[model samples]
Target: MRVMTKSALRLLAVPLAVLGLLFGTAAPASAHAALVGSDPAQGSVVKTAPAQVRLTFSEGVLLSRDAIRVLGPDGERAETGDANDAGRGNTTAAVALRPGLGNGTYTVAWKAVSADSHPVAGAFTFSIGAPSKTSVALPTQEVGGGAVGTLYDIARYAAYLGFALLIGAAFFIGVCWPDGARTRPMRRLVATGWATMVAATILLLMLRAPYANGGTLGDAFDLGGVRDVLDTRPGAALLSRLLLLAAGAVFIAVLFGSWAKREDPVERQDLAWGLAIGGTVVSVGLAATWAMAEHASVGIQASVAMPVDIVHLLAMAVWLGGLTALLAALWGGHRVERATVRRFSRIAFGAVVTLVVTGVYQSWRQLGSWDALVSTGYGQLLLVKVGLVILLVELAWLSRRWTARLGETAVRGRAAAVAQPVAAGRKGAGGGGGDASERAGQLARQEAALAKERARKERDGDAERTGLRKSVLAEVAVAVVVLAVTTLLTGTQPGRAAEEGAAQQASAPVSEVPEPLDVRIPFDTGGTDGKGEAEVTMDPGGIAENELHLLVTAPDGRAFDVPEVQISFTLKSKKIGPIPVTLGKVDTGHWSAANVQIPVPGEWTIAVTVRTSDIDQVTRTKVVKIGS
Candidate 1:
């Protein structure tokens, strides 16, 4: 007994340690679909205006007719029509551009619904002929920002939880434990799951429009917005999920109806079989809705990927859902039967195996390589998820041990139950041969002894029930965290997207040299030699950290001397620091600063302050592009 207790404690320690590691290492990374690439790529200058603008994403995207906008140098809409899917799989969106807009820069602002139902928005610029200054602004926030996204994420998590509970509990009642149906609480749990799922689906549908368009909270219920959402893939998916849930409810009602009647075993057995088979079919179809609207439907060989993903979701539902069912219905009340626990244990084991197999396939497809696992943000999150699951598996092992103990105790209990009655009967009979009054007294004593044994058995059963409940609760707690991670992961970019982006960068024309920052700033002071040129040089400049060099030339084109030169950089978009850097006088006419870091990706303001004399200086600001 002590050895088993120690083993259980050791098992408990694994998930606790894993939870510590999970929370310690996991961070909230940027979520939303990744931009794979765009035509007339970021910061590219083309000699001719393209007919249409196209953007590709790492996952499938449902493009709204008005999702894409192209603005020309005149700050007017240059796009000719509404955006459309450029390909069949929902990965690309394109909008026509007005031709011959006379050689300037154009900005493309787009909004899209990713396969996982998250809204993403972004903007980039491309130039036709020489680049010209324009007033088109980039999107400040990704769609589904602030409270909307939080609420949406919560809804997603809830939906998953409800699905698991409803499906797992129904499955348990129909197949593993027919007695579970007799309990009102267990039946109510199934109803709660279905209701939760239905509520979440409706919530997601209502929020879909405002989320995708980056509109205000009030926009969630706009009649037009909701109608527009119904036209999209995500909305369709949610509707399908609701319909499936409704059908499932009917099946559950009938299946449990049989148990409620407490009919003959032969009739109940047939009903149970029908429920199991029908339930499996409905669940698979429901799982397909998720696959159709998520990462599973994107990427390579989606035909194969989709099925694997469905299985993965089902496996999760069975394992975690069953754990929740056990905690809620079985151990929470009367002591569960040994056979029920053993059946669930077997089901959990099978589910775990399925999880492993499907998870491996997903990792390979999403991560692509080992380097991605360590380097990419998505990969790092995957590691966190894997860690949590490993711990959950350990917790499962502990619960199985407790189950075995419960089985042994139950067997011992039955043995005592049978043995005590037999012994009492023999004692009464033996006394009967001696005297009639003695026999009556012996029988009375025997009845009291049997009552005492029954009480003892009940006490033992309670103890075992308490032990089992504790194990299950601990397991459920860990499983909830795992589900949270899975939810977060759904909205995050895959490592495959990151790798493709890197590959695109690598394949860019090496022959194309980086443009240098050659700004000639005119400065003036109180002195007669005030009017002069401060020529600044930044080698290999666009977006990279590079050295800064300054050379001062007088109005007469002679070498002009400056007392001190300093530079300040500010990234207004990100509200980054106005980092100040002082230049060292290198020679008669020059000053330089080496290895200056830009820090973030975007346009940065570089201001140069040159002092010609005491209290005599001029500061010049110029915007420069920084690389990602």
Candidate 2:
């Protein structure tokens, strides 16, 4: 009991250290669903309304009945039919447009489930007969941001954690800790894991709607939103997971209790077979639910990828879960058994090999190119995870060495224990003919020496156990980071998706390419007869918030110094009031405003006032087209 308490304290310390590192530099949540290209490409101007709206993603997507919505100038839905999957890999979704759909500008708001069952939603605008002065409001809330998104991600992380604990720990208790089956702590841990998963799944289900629509926390329980989620693949996948968990609970109880604690060999053998088959079926089913809703269910060679993914998840559960069980149950007691430790070492080794093999294949499939490891956010994160895994392997190696040492010590101690009793018996027999007092004295000395030797061996055993405990704790600390990274990785866009998107952008025709919103206007003021050019560049030159760069140059094209620079924006067609923008001077002799808000699509008149001298100031107005 003392050993258990001490080891639990040591185990608790590892995760606490890791939690500090995890939250200190946590990455933002990013979904895997990436927009590839759409018909009437984003921010495009078409002479006529197209027959349909088509959206393509990097991987396959499952759409809700209300998946693709086209809103015309009046903010009325223009889609005529349900959105359907199209193109190869079911990666494209298309919806018919109403005939003669008049548009100043049309917004396409869409919702879909990625191959990995994460729900994604986004909105874009396209125009008919040149860009319109007024367009339907783009869906600013397509993805839940801020608090709701945070909560949704938290739910996902919890689910992953719970699944690992429940599944892995149960496997350990059933396979390696039959003696511990009746322990209260072991049962309670398993129960806690199961309950956590249940709660997390429910939380996720509730958050699905708000996450898809970019709504507030209040919208989490909105019945309509929840209904919408249920209509989608991700929702169904979540539902299936719930069903599996519920069913598996019964078998989990059996495996951890009746089958594990049975004393009858024949009955135990039969129950073992039952548990093996029943548990395997349940595990594979649960894994399939994960695979069906994630990236492995879509993309290249999805058929092969799905099964590989199942294997990967199962391997993770076994390794991580088994480690937890070994630490909390096997090593928690007064004595750490050599046989149990050695058996687990073998099991852990196999799990590691499986993790490596499957991980490599998944990485290749998701990343596609070598440069992606450094080029994409997801790849960089994956690299970090891989580095931590490498560290974990080294820690495992250290722990393995300790296990070997423990095994050696146990063997030598047993031999010494056996030899001591035989030598003491010989001494007692030889002393029968000696003086009573002398015989008694000799026996007392032998007993004292034997007790001292036993104490020394006990101390040595405790020291080895302590060393092993520390190594295991360190390994567990690193595993926590690995799990966090994996959770984040699932939420991030695959590197292959990013590469594919870039290729699509690069392949577009020059005429169709978005023109840089870089404008240079030359002006002359009568006061000093000084001439200068004002060059303005707006990155992501659209009606959306943009970065504005204003550079002033003299007639000689040299950097022209201005006493003050003021910039303001107004939508002429919308008759909106001029919104004053403050600019800061940058080292490059340019005035910059990081976020220039252009609320709606129209001809935005950007008025830049530059004071060359206090008395010789001029304002230059440039009419720039901004799209919603």
Candidate 3:
């Protein structure tokens, strides 16, 4: 068998690329990715001193998020101190209980944007000095809060398994099964696996949210919500995945077509081979979606991440998906074609080598430093994945040795020689000593038949050797399982290990860390074209001061301030709350919203209509959420 032949290596192109992607950067599901579990045990109570309120989640919660807040029994913010995020599995936030938290009720409300951009939230109350937090604990709300994260983990695992298995079945159909073995039973598994993968893809999209704030089933199908999602990165990635899936449907057509024309080797190769590569390319495209959605939006970063992402997807396809192909070749029960075995060996060698080098580079960029490897969940999971990869390499080495043994066996013809000598002995014994001279002559004539038998026996033995090789490939198939399991583990925090590592490195801040804060708009300046912000001071206790800083542009486009302008706040709605609408005298096309006491936190629509000749620039509905 020619090694690295075109046919054998062509299937390899996608797999090599896929392996690169797997080792290159963490997949979307792994590496500080999603929310998994939460703390406070999600509605448990205790009598002991908790020191600080805590929340545990599935994935690392960004330390920059600001949505976790604790409310005291008296309906006051019980912010004794700041919070800290572990950035691994069980993140802890410290909000000191009101120094004298009276023995009563409390609520811990939290909202978070997961690494997948889905919003996860929940409220848990723990009573002080009591064994019970709530007389009525709500379990359903807790589930609804964490459902996105829960479903995400499930979808990822399902996709990976389906990907590896469906491709494996295709390989089996083409390479292994006897001409008669393509039965209804085998067909069912293939169809089911593909269907599962497609279903998971759809489920993942329905679960993925934009900017977190939490999403729901209604949001999943809402026309406006869908539009907002498509406007974001995650949405675009889903669209790309859908396109790739459509391309994979092409594989389905090719697959059945080939099965129907198995006798035509040309047509079989055309359909089977084409579908394998095409389906693989489309399937691997899912990995690239992460880049499009996350890093690629930045200019320079996009250039680097996009190519790297492509390499990453291709490498994964080669390693995980190729495992299926190689395993089938190994087990396919045919007189194992030496050519096929050699082809797989050659491709595997090159792919593993590429994976190691690129993997190191990708790790350097993502993990940042040696400290990261031990101090971050992303780093630890990567280490575990690498360990599994090394184990796979060792398995490959063992299989390669077996391959070489056969290579030597084929060259030496030792089996034929063994049978030839034994058959010659039997024929010699058959000729009797009574007719000694005649016996010698007869044995010579039988030598040709004995030689022929030896060749036939050696050929039969080849079948057995091929079967043994197939078993080795079966062993190789286990690597895919290890990889899929690793994918799920990647999404979880290596919190315990990372914390220990942080302490060991003396990098834990001298001061206890603060709880994460969700930064909003970076508190940017409002419209900086000399549009001065007037000071509108209002006391919730009922008094108000109106100071208008009106800067009006002159006819020549110059600016001047109308120091003395009338400003007042008016009640907009008589129905709900103290909904205030700000009003100001329109002085030469400029207006201001003066004294306003939005006594409540709901929708405050401030109507500012700047009247000008033939034009009224009216910001009549400026809705804002006050106090939150």
Best-fitting candidate, measured by TM-score? 1
Across 1-628, the per-residue lDDT of candidate 3 in tens digits comes to 2332343344345654664564455322222322233344433444554556665553444432345666654566665655666444434444455555554445667665443433445555655543212233322333224566666767767766666556555545544442312444445545665777788777766665522445555555566656655655566777777777677666655566455457877876676666657765765575676555442222223467556755654555455555554454333322345555565566666767666655554554355445567767666777777666656666666566566656545424734554565666566667567686477556655765665566556644665455445545655566655666555543543333233333433531121111211111111112233232332332221211222333345344554444332332333553453333444655553444544433433434433333232332222234443322
Q: Give every collision pair in model 2.
A: 30-491, 115-294, 116-293, 116-294, 116-295, 117-293, 143-214, 144-214
How well does candidate 2 match the true structure in TM-score terms?
Answer: 0.66
TM-score of decoy 1: 0.69
Provide the clashing-pair count of each candidate structure: 2, 8, 32
Instruction: Report clash pairs, candidate 1.
Output: 543-626, 543-627
| Per-prediction TM-score | 0.69, 0.66, 0.47
Better of 1 and 2 by lDDT: 1
Off by over 4 Å in 3: 1-73, 76-148, 166-193, 209-232, 258-284, 294-302, 328-332, 407-478, 489-628
lDDT assessment of candidate 1? 0.75
| Cα distance off (Å), candidate 1, residue 524 | 14
Q: lDDT per prediction? A: 0.75, 0.74, 0.50
- Per-residue lDDT of model 1, residues 25-113, tens digit only: 43322123566678878667777888888887766677777789888867899999899988957778889887667776677788887
Which candidate, 2 or 3, would have the higher TM-score against the true structure? 2
